[model samples]
Target: QMQGALEQHLARLNELLASRGDYVQTLKFTQQLAGSIVLQLQGLPAWRGVSADLTELSGQVAYVEYYRWLAYLLFFILVLTVCLLACLGLAKHSRCLLLLMLCCGLLMLVLSWASMAVDTAAAVGTSDFCVAPDKFIMNQTDDEISAEVVHYYLYCDQSLSSPFQQALTVFQRSLTTMQIQMQGLIQYALPLFPTAEKDLLGVQQLLNSSETGLHQLTALLDCRGLHKDYLDGLIGICYDGVEGLLYLGLFSLLAA
Candidate 1:
């Protein structure tokens, strides 16, 4: 009986020794895992504030900005036209043409100013699209680049806008609408071969495209006055191209 008890005690001692070894090994591994996790968490960066300043920037956001500036230019042109009219008004020159020119210029100027006021909404709205890295956590590509733009052109345009970039979105929606109108004109002409309707439609399209292109170009340059000659030359070309389309469509319809 004594020998049997001794054997049982030895068996229990061996089990305890094996369990203690395993516990020591497991504890060591757990400590390493916990320490690694702590280190990794420590390496992570904290949040930084995102920001934007309108006056300090000019890029994609500048497109809308330039539109605003153009109104100011229209104002300048209006003033020049006004001065010309006033000089002629005093000179007793062909008062009719002067008056007409003056009226047109003044009207255009007023419209431009009004449009400028409205476009401010566009500029303010773009602020939403502005991605401040801290506030917005996006893949680097999406935050800094517009994948749609051929160049992934750093949409350097400061969109630093409101919650949803509402104004910016609405402004873009308008551009998209203009695009749709342009598309509709083309589609309308497709079924009709050289008809008057088709001719008119094509002419209108050319004009629309020309105008949109001109607006885009002027907007692209942020109205810095650096590309006046380029814009002027392009405008003349686009105008002639549109007029030419009108004439061509007219002649084609006449022949048909």
Candidate 2:
């Protein structure tokens, strides 16, 4: 029975790790898409502000990656230290080493409890994020893009796929139609209303700037921002991280 339980726990651990790997891959893809969007639009004055947000997100992703590996290293070292102390105490029958090992084990127990508390809070926060991710996504949006429109992009699963594709198509056609209308205005209306030239010029600049935003819009319309953040938080806090904390808790109990 003990062996069976151990096997089951190990299997669950493997499954969690595999799921975490998938989340990491998704995060990498999201980072790439965000970088591309930022690169494409940041040259335009319209995109300057959002570009900073994207940069900050990318930096956060890098930090996540860094801290993940760092945690792995620390956990490995913790386990190694315990095993070494146990072996030394067993082979030499040293009371001093056993006392030191007990002291270290007690410290680990305290740390594990603290870590578990933090992880639990993080899991709760992530649960909240996953529940209403659209609100978070909308917060990152620029003034020019409506929150509803941005929501469509991040949540574009199978049901939404067709509608967004059609929206893009319609947007493109509208641009073409506006170009035709502008040509007519320049040719005929400008002759009688020379004063309208300034307004026309303003419209032209707006259209050009809109094109830059459109490029970004099409990219952001995919699952790159909020969805990624929610998934990352979900897996990082609730699954792999929490599982590791549980294992540490188990180890501390056993050591004590």
TM-scores of all candidate predictions against the true structure: 0.27, 0.48
Cα lDDT tens digits, model 2, 68-149, are 5697578558767977997899799999889988887777667666655655565566666667766765775847556555
- Clash totals, every prediction: 6, 1
- Per-residue lDDT for 103-206 in model 1, tens only? 87667556655555444443343333332422232343344433332121223233432222333344344445544543553454334423334433433454
Best by TM-score: 2
In order, the Cα lDDT scores of the candidates are 0.43, 0.58
Would you give me the overall lDDT of model 2?
Answer: 0.58
Between which residue pairs do clashes occur in model 1? 61-157, 125-168, 127-159, 127-160, 127-161, 128-161
